[model samples]
Target: MKVKTGTLNRVRIIGGDWRSRTLNFPNQAGLRPTPDRVRETLFNWLGQTLYGKTCLDLFAGSGALGFEALSRGAKQLVMVEQNRPVLDALKKNSEMLKAQNVEMNHADGVQFISRETRQYDVIFLDPPFRQEYLPKLLPLLPERLTPEGVVYVESEGAIDPGEGWEVWRCSRAGQVHFHLLKRTHA
Candidate 1:
């Protein structure tokens, strides 16, 4: 379950401006980047273009999802990661890509979400699989989205949208269950 630290691993940008580009990340436990097949499916569900959208990548491990959004024309991307090494890699990749629209934050995902007042067009939630973050986080997302916004959640297994949220799309790849969720009434 844990990859050796200090090993070099990289993920490729599957489409958009940075297509075929690679970004390196440290091999840290639970630091899984969204896999290529899963990301391709998720982006397809989101539509290929993210033009002018504001996105938040909470629990951003490798910055894969956020960077992909930026590459696809998102207006802005905010990535929050609490792990120091992972955060460093994210910063390095942001600079490496000349990502002017990306913002990196070092903070706990739940704490950051608690204090954030601005809503996002898309929010990527890919927390550590061992933690029960979904139960607490799902309830907080509806208020954090724009009226027509969506939230992409990746977990170890299938998860319900809970209460006011509805599943826009859902799929599985290996051990990951990923879903695009939207507020039912919004």
Candidate 2:
């Protein structure tokens, strides 16, 4: 459901230095932020601390996952958002939090991934649920991750972890099927 323009909606940081802090974001269609429970669970699976880890939040909507990582001690975070208004809101939230570790990019997630050369310790993939981006994006992830890196994916339905990848953790919350994935060794 799309949040009406001009209506204020907030998402709270679940843990870390900014625990319990709330960030207000403009609601746009297809801009669903990962739910608090899911974030908490995902982080728990990730061990609750991201100190010195580099992260990438592809298709960053409300900047929720990226900001959460930063709050939990990620050394660097890159958030890529395509929507102008949503991107503006993300930038505002980053500035409000005085976030120095975040790098906001106004770009398409697919395009960014196709050209990105640096590897990330953790990558968050939460594209618009209606798009069939997973089939295309998943194939590109392994090369983007550091050897021990992980990819957190949120989808509307079950996802098949294609070649060279394995599901490390999986759970469901309502209609969301979230998974933590890792690359399999040859």
- Residues 1-186, candidate 1, lDDT per residue (tens digit)? 546878879999999999999999998877889999999999999899899999999999988899999999999999999999989999999888999888889999999998898899999999999799988888888888999999999999888878898888999999999999989873
Question: Would you estimate the TM-scores of all the predictions?
Answer: 0.97, 0.97
Model 2, 1-186: lDDT tens digits are: 535788767999999988988888886877778999999999999999999999999998888899999999999999999999888888989998899878889999999999999999999999998878998899998899999999999999878889899999999999999999999999
Colliding pairs, model 2: none
**Minimal lDDT window, size 10, model 2:** 1-10
What's the count of clashing pairs in each model shown?
0, 0
For model 1, the superposed segments whose C-alpha errors exceed 4 Å read 1-3
After best superposition, candidate 2 residue 35: deviation in angstroms? 0.9
Given candidate 1, what's the lDDT at residue 120? Answer: 98
Model 2 misplaced stretches (Cα beyond 4 Å)? 1-3
Whole-structure CA lDDT of model 1: 0.92
Each prediction's Cα lDDT score? 0.92, 0.92
Give model 2's clash tally.
0
Cα-based lDDT at residue 151, candidate 2: 97
